[model samples]
Target: MLIINIHPTETAWSFVDDTASTCSIHHYSKPIPMETIRQESRILYLISPGQNDLQLAPEEQRTVSQQAPHIQTIFRDCLRANPRADHRLLSENRFYQNLPPLSTRYALPADLATRFQRAGRDALTHQWAWIKAKSILPEVKSLISIHLNSAPNAVAIKNGQPVDLSAGFSQMDGLPGFHSCGEIDPSLCLTLSEKGEPPAAIEHLLAAQSGLSSVSPELASFSQIFEQPESLASKVLSHQLKKTIGGMASALNALEAIVFSGEITPALTAWLVDLLEPLTAFGFIPTSTISCESITRLNSPASRIQVFLMEDTPWKIAYEMFSQAQPLQS
Candidate 1:
């Protein structure tokens, strides 16, 4: 039985333990499970920071970026409004005082800070501490893997143990995430730092506030942009979709190898493959067909292909391919 703890977004973590055969998966919105409390198992936890939640719109982006200062002001006001709410830690204004130094290169605004503060607080409460506590379980057998978007050295160290990290499925080195600007010039960070940008702001731009959000004007939803596409934004969206499909295929192939090698059952393999198909499709194709070549390329112990054709190109043909497969259960 494998216990997979996946942080779907940088701000949230979900735990899916495959041990019970029934496969119970839980979002980290409440208290840790009793099983987690009792097992004391050394769980394999993966962390990939700087991922985005649901896509935002252009107006939201502009408001967040342009009105960043006002947003920060409001955030501070919110803190001040709740005088008894840990004002000491919140009063320092680190998030605001630290912004200009950070946005020199990326032009971050106050709304981002406010959103981060809110999301970060919720994430810490519902996910991080809970996982940290669970990590001490004696029943946990192994610390198998970790994922991170940035360098592992940057992650906070606690009790001298390095957190296992993976850069997430989207961050395959050069592959851009939903909101990352993707790979940057190596000297870019040095240049930004030398110019006196705050480390926090640099980190924020590099991880949280880049990617699709940078290109699209609408902040609330990428789907909105797709519905009414302009030339430039449409191109960016197309590229991002292609990259996403490639990444999903890569992850699927990796999982398939494990299953095919007898590490997991056929049923589990089928279940995962079916589950991810819709997500990978993203309206580009209704269904996806995995070819033997793609599977072999992805699973080859020595092969290192970064991209592959998972299905026929042209939405019409791809949709037809999807129709031929067993309908994916909703």
Candidate 2:
């Protein structure tokens, strides 16, 4: 089995150099040895092999084509030149066709496009297209995995055991992903969509346009505002920060139990605890310790907590309880 490690920054070919007759030298980069390569070979890994992760605009395309001519050229050359070689290129950006019907470019505002044009272009999109088009090997299955700042809601669980969807979903529920809103108001979505807005626009509003941006107009980032002194806005900001931390902690705990197991080191546990500290301070449910326990307890065959958590019933009770508990503060 040929194992190829394609990084996001550079493309490196790894194969037994059969050309060398005396002792076949393993033709892998000095930076990454052949032994390390073997360790990561249980699952197939593909990378886009680009410098940075940045979405480019239409105008910046020309400059990128000029500067990173070799990136795309190498990709095309690799698939075309070496058809038999088993390799996968990892990318940060999604690719779409440039010509007529095939092309449905990212729908963004003109101002955003102009800003992106000023920034340097990303070679990921181009590399993705080239790989998809040329690589037609029957053995190679095209698997695309995107790593976001947040945790994923779904993950493929691979073991000697049979493939199970229930197991995957159960593992996924604890994780906070980029796409998931993490305790969203279904009524808000229904109300917004009822007004005849497009589904795509609603999706963008929920995913990209909401959160910290919606809350703070003056501040560009949540971290910047988080540094400010206590105020009504700061309190709200604190709450948001706490909630985010809780979600992240829950995700890490779930991942540890289902995937990492003994591999879950002290550093990882520390990171998870650190994330949950703010949430604990804010009186949000302690996520790190009770996350898995809560999932198990709430999802039991005979449990009322599941219904409460699922349908926002507990939120009402919590609000009332808080109101009664701290009347003077309220």
Candidate 3:
């Protein structure tokens, strides 16, 4: 059996032929280039790993040597351009990279930083190994994971080819990325520091224990808050997402679609669509349920934004990686 994990900045895998042996690792900065996939246009697709979640059709199931494509330059801005820290790489013994950069001089300046460089590299190693195990060559590059689901457009067939309507772009990550408090007033940290809350501790609080968790003690994780939509927690999440989505909408002028994926996607999308205030909710979904059942249409049909809830992003990344590799090997 082989286990593979895909993350925003890394991928990891382990082949258990020798249970006692430790899993080996590999790394790569860029994904298989986009131009490469367009030229070769064939891949040996992998089976859909998701069965319990959203199921892709027989033809929809991920394929190897598939001809898929996407192009939109200004549209490309929608892709994830993470914190500078994510791009940092360490060539010397592979240390001090992949961690979100700490701004000691910034408003909330810190004296020290705890890095996750090794963890990022390890993940890449295992992911590449899985690629090699399948007799694949050339490293995988581009990837788009929403709610951890990476299916291409279900209704995008035209001229016998699927179109990239969304340009594989995503919302602003690290805008309080799940746990991290994206950007905050430096005064809060300074005030905390003045009150004798150690700077490192303050950083820890903001980085790990902030965001949705900061607002409630009962909510253990974002998944819990989104999954169990009962009271203020759900309302709070809905409000936050609304503001974020609204800001994004303003910047883009208009949205064609919205894909919500990851562990919390189902609950997040449902609760948000259901709690779009009464008027706003009515705008998105005309008839919602008491239990807040999953809704395909949260907004009016005329409205442009189409929301989707998906799962299994790791597999999606695998396809993107494989697609990129196809052209190079050919």
lDDT of 2 at 329: 10
Tens-digit per-residue lDDT, 1-330, candidate 1: 112232323112223233322223445554344454334322222222233321223345455345435324433543343333211111111111221222112234766543332111112111222232233332322221111112110111122222221122223223344456665675888999999999888877877777655666474543333344453544554454344434433433331111111112233233334323443333212123333431211222332221111211112211222212222111
> By TM-score, is 1 or 3 better?
3
**lDDT per residue (tens digit) for residues 73-124 in model 2:** 5445444444444434333333221212111122457675333321112223
lDDT of 2: 0.31
Model 3 C-alpha lDDT per residue in residues 1-330, reported as the tens digit of each score: 222232323434332222223235333344534442233322222222221111122243234113222212211321222111111111111111222222111233232212111111122222322333223212222121123211111111112111211211111112343455544666888999999999789877876666555666677656776677875655565664555455444433443344444443556656656645443432443334323233233454454334444332343334334433322110
Q: Which consecutive 10 residues in model 3 have the weakest lDDT in total?
A: 84-93
- lDDT at position 114, candidate 1: 35
Which rank order by TM-score, best down to worst?
A: 3, 2, 1
Q: What stretches of model 1 exceed 4 Å from their correct place? A: 1-25, 28-173, 237-330
The TM-score that candidate 1 achieves is: 0.29
lDDT of 1 at 72: 40
